[model samples]
Target: MSTLEIKDLHVSIDTDQGNVPILRGVTLTINTGETHAIMGPNGSGKSTLAATIAGHPRYRVDGGSILLDGEDVLSMSVDERARAGLFLAMQYPVEVPGVTMTNFLRTAKTALDGEAPSLRHWTRDVKKAMGDLRIDADFAQRNVNEGFSGGEKKRVEILQLELFHPRFAILDETDSGLDVDALKIVSEGVNREHAKGGMGTLLITHYTRILRYIKPDFVHVFIAGRIAEQGGPELADRLEEEGYDRFTAVEA
Candidate 1:
């Protein structure tokens, strides 16, 4: 089974003022077939943790370690991390102006698998996955995220999650801006992948609505870049009702 461990991770971002600390001693472990939800208010260093795991340059690893199956993930480059089976579905997936969805997905899959999938089967697989996500058939021809609605863009992110089938998926606020129907659809797509097993998940979000659908095995309440509390599904229910006042007040 695969395992991704974050051990006392400390991360910082460069700012006009100076290097600003973001993730301070944040640690968590996600093993194959497990789902861990990290929920907190905005600016609690949630996305910074995700971006750091995915090796975004702006976020510098100031201290601590991230290990994948006992190998050092902190040393891997962004693409290398992907090849190592770590995937991050960003909250804002960028537009690739010249890249059609088909080409982008195909290219990414090829790079990850180290072999180009056969055209016939690849086409069929893409179509089926798209259909599963309720994506329009014509999106294959459209430029990636170009002229797409916010919900559509988020659905495409889930499309990548389904198609890539990574060993671990770090979804950063995937439910943001999605309507109830879109949220359910995206959550179901994630659930489909989770059901396949050997897929670890770290779902980060401000609200607990997605948890109602995705159902995390553990719920961690993050405050000021630290895990202030942890519990089972009931924790999520509590957060939905009580909000983050307790956590944020503690941070204050």
Candidate 2:
């Protein structure tokens, strides 16, 4: 099985006040078929970790390592990382005004697989995945995320997750702005891939609500850019009851 290992990761960003640290020596591991939930308060560096792993230029790696199946992930470019089987479902899925969803998905799949999928099979696969995500057929013709509702954009992100089938996925606050029914539909798409026993997941979230739908194998409490505590699913239950105050010496 594939493995993603984060070893003492340190990330920072430039600000008017000068460089500010975000992720402070974070270390964790995720394996194929496993789901690890990173729960934290806002500004606790949860998104920073995801961005760094995804090779976003804004987040600078001060020090540490991110290994994907023992390969040096930190050395790879953003596109290189994706081609190597890493996926990030952004907290804010951006809009591509002119690119149709179908074209975008096919192009991305072709890039990742190093060969174009046969048109017939590709069409059927995309249609089935869209149906599974409850995405309307009309979206296939619409520009990517152009004028999509929050829930719709999120569903489309998961649609990519299913179609791309990466070896590892980092979902950064994917539950944001989702209603109950939409959340369930999105979670089912994720669960469907997870049940396949080939992809690992790092789910970054703020609430336990989504956790109810996508059960995590391990739970980490991130506070002040570091994991202050870690445990099994029960930790999420405790967080729901007690909140992150216990983990953060300061107010959360």
lDDT for each of the candidates?
A: 0.92, 0.94
TM-score of each: 0.98, 0.98
lDDT of 2: 0.94
Separate clash counts for every candidate = 0, 0
- Per-residue C-alpha lDDT of model 2 across residues 5-50, encoded as one tens digit per residue: 9999999999999999999999999999999999988989999999
Give the residue spans of candidate 1 off by over 4 A.
none
N/CA/C clash count, model 1:
0
Error of 1 at 238 (Å): 1.0
What is candidate 1's CA lDDT for residue 148? 92
